[model samples]
Target: MGAWSKVRRVFTRDANIVTAEDLLSLAREDRLGGRTVHVTNDSALRHSAVWAALRLRADLVSMMPIDVYRQVQGLQVEVPKPPVLISPGGSEVGIKEWMYSTQFDLDRAGNCFGIITERTGVIGPDGRGLPGRIDLVELGEVTVRAKGPQISKYKICGVDYDPWDVWHERQYTVAGFPLGLSPVAYAAWSIEESLNAQQFARDWFGAGIVPSGTLKNTSKTIDRKNAREAKESFRAAVSNGDVFVHGADWEYKPIQAVAQQAQFVEARQFGMGDIARFFGVPGDLIDAAVSGSSVTYANISQRNLQFLIMHLGPAVGRREDAFSRKLLSNPRYVKLNTDALLRMDPQTRAATIAAQINSRTLTPSEARALEDRPPFTEDQYAEFDRLFGSRSVPTPPPTAPTGATS
Candidate 1:
């Protein structure tokens, strides 16, 4: 087992890549009042000083040295900073009374890191695209890491979303396996949590808690029951768009693939069961058993995700996170000769699969659905119609009826 297999409960995976420039753009798109990192560094905004600032509260301001002030654009947007007071002598109300002194200076990235690192933190992918721990730099010499978060900052599929309030905001939505999971308790009451429990008993069916034959039969029985439960989950998430039903093709392929190979899901289940037992929280709500550093209350979360992936299938790219319009065309997963391999390698397979694809045909409805989406332009549409008649597949246009008619 890898470290991930040890506790097997908590972990982060990077699917979101927001660069410094990207952050600046996002800030601009929001029409921020702060123009530069410097002006934004005011104590009130806390951009230059705090360990973390919510997107709603903070704005990225670019900073300029006295010499480079002219080169920086967008100076008009800088928000006004609050006044900083001077604290001096024993006569001062307090020795370090000026809260401004503790805040950050936007001109200094080092100081900015110091403040944010001390507050909330950022996690991202290492060069390898795996989840690396979150850390902030201090004075360009020291490193400060996120102790633990008070929210859900991890990227899923490919989006970074922190949409909840209260439990997911102040502290990590699920944290401190030993601390009793600050707000993980609320998840226990969620519909998703109960589904995890149902899936759990099914995964354990063949563990041989009973006679061999009985265990096999019991496992099958459990699987059958779980299937209906799983479908209920699928329908709920789909209708709600938590998991989408892509037309008919790509929608549930990932889910089916995951179900077929839910071996990873099973091991993960046992891991969470152990964690729940350790913490005395309900197993359905908390899964603390991590392969290594994965412990905490994310266990149930992981299981719920497994169930989703088991039904929806994994995806790639930004919009890929939400079930796309692709799935409705091929709901089940299949290989090159089959169906439901998400986003086939358009480049490499274009030639080889062309022959295989051309051999098959589609019905009127299927053919129409295959039409390339518009803004393909009227000219492009006419060209295709001229060539392939009505089919979207790449076959040469039908030979116009000899010399018969116009």
Candidate 2:
């Protein structure tokens, strides 16, 4: 059995799983700037860096088109016009929106939920249901209702759905837990640290660029009413507008403190980097400072390749497997075409395509398709042959070195 299967079995059979009451308590513990870190999708996304990272990843995955293929005699054949492929939900938004929503939820909450509907009168001979329509459910609205280790049912949008009817995609989960652990929840301290820093900066500026200090009235016998008036006047003059002048020893001594003194900027940047790590996005990708690599990157395609392999590969693989298991049967698989992200400069791409065409790994028509161009017509083929025809030439034998052999 696979590792996931083992984990599932252990989780389903474990007796020490948290009860419904505990799960509710854990799930509900979220507040902004509170002692306990709240890591809900809405609250966590308030940070711009986190939102941007999630958006980038979701769009990157969802923008890719999904291809469905069937196995016939041990060969995979592309399935065109499959009901599930065309429209998974029988809605106007189609697959891209569905994928975007699902990926967003998966990235933010570490879980995604979908409802599956089988096609009517389209069942195959093997008694397997034909996939008809699938719909994505908001991750925030779904609640896991479990009895011991096993999940009893899923409550979504005030309706109860059987475990079989709901398709669940989850990320990291601890032992005996039916729900996946969100990155925000796991890294709440880091995210909250960032949020606190942001709030501090806002308050600092809101209090004006002037630091906190005492305002002394050197005038003899100042009344309480006069002191209050002077305080409000000073605040209005300093915070509301620009320059202000005070008469007679009524001076405002400002506290000398800077953000750099406390490394506030550095802390905020570090927090952003931490969030990026949780999302599997490179710090440099989201404009966060890349500490080690300060050199300029000349090869964008190479960087994109590394990102695809190192960062996005696992998430995309999980999505593919989920589609394969739930929407397709054995021997058939689903794939998200990532060639678009691998595109290079025109000249470089042309050279690469030429190499592939020469090696028979890609045809001219296929290369054209990659460029979103039409396939070659017979006339174009004739022209190509005329320009570059097959030919064989005889080579002269090597000559002896001049005046060498005696």
Candidate 3:
């Protein structure tokens, strides 16, 4: 017992070392009926629906730009992005890649962790230095221990890290729980069902347990040796892709496996919908069919808006809040521009922009910025005036007092 304790202490103290026992303890396995299905982070990704849902959310969030803003004079103004926001994982990993990695982990495991590798000289209000670079750690390697509503320790690859030294974000949280609830863990049953169906299909086809058809002698009874000889001859001919010559007494009928195949396919489709629900993704977004209901959108923008409001909005908001608290100081916050996801077709976007400009809700310059164009120069304005008249509204003739105005 003393020797085992010493061995355990040595493994825990060394960050670079690991044992087979530690890895086996961390691996997740689900036993359904008589079979065991390994449910690790990588194995969960084998399911197509899980892959599509995670990819959709991660790709969308990563492409959207993240900006920092400061509150000044009761209004928010955009500020220069810090180093962390620009290249969080270092020069090789841009903000997009970093965001994608973190969002993927958050969607799958309901939490993400990173090591704060670099810090700026500027200190936040909490007396802690601001992080300049954060390198994300794999979810499998991290083990978290927490007190009520607070994390007590983080173990990554057998080494302990202080909570302050680690960057952590969580979603799908419950009251009095320090760690978030994992979608993958909750949907393990559905995943196992799908995986089992897939394996059965593979085995059914690969092993050739079910023959295409059966042969029988109708004219007279055949001896066991003759029957075996006939079966072997027929199999050899079929395997060689040649026709077997036989007498009229023998009959062959082909069988179709359509019904059997369809059963497993339907099971897979149902599993797809269940997985989509677990990840807060729309079934149609991942091409999974939803039964008995058809929804149509006037435009893609409206569809995107619906998804944002109903599903993705709260998650995005939570992420922004996390970023603000961990990466910025007081009075400064972070925002992920969701306009990228709400982009419409050219015609609809043009009409929307024109309407906003006409209603004085959006300026022409601001509209141009949205389209990634610079404001018109003097020469360009002159050319526009030559083709079309000046855009400025005309002034009315001088009027008398309000009571006498005509």
lDDT of each: 0.27, 0.71, 0.80
Count of steric clashes across candidates, in order: 49, 2, 0
- Candidate 3 lDDT: 0.80
Clash pairs, candidate 3, are none
**Which lDDT value does model 2 have at 401?**
94
Which digits, one per residue and each the tens of the lDDT, describe model 3 over residues 1-406?
3433443443455543432233333323434474345665678899999999999999999998998999899999999988999999999899999999999988988788899888888796568789988989887778765544666678887889988889989888777656666788667778767886786676556654333677888999889999999989988887545688998899987564546554878889899999999999999999986788679999999999999998888999999998898899878899999998999999999999888877878888888898889986788878877878884422334668877844
lDDT of 2 by residue, 254-328 (tens): 875554535657777888888999888888888886567664556878888989999998888888887777666
Task: Write candidate 1's Cα lDDT for 1-406 as tens digits.
Answer: 3321221122222322222122112222123462222211122122111222211011111111001011136342322211111111123322122112211222112122211111112211211211111122222232121223322342333333332200111112123321111111221222122333334344435331211111122222346786666555555664333543333222233322234234545544454454343222333333333444542433433543443343212211111211112111212111111022222345533444555556554333343344452334567668888998873645445778878786
TM-score of 3: 0.77
User: Of the candidates shown, which would achieve the greatest TM-score relative to the real structure?
Assistant: 3
RMSD of each: 28.5, 8.9, 8.0
Candidate 2 stretches with Cα past 4 Å from truth are 1-39, 116-131, 207-211, 215-252, 256-262, 295-298, 372-406
At residue 333, candidate 2 shows an lDDT of 81
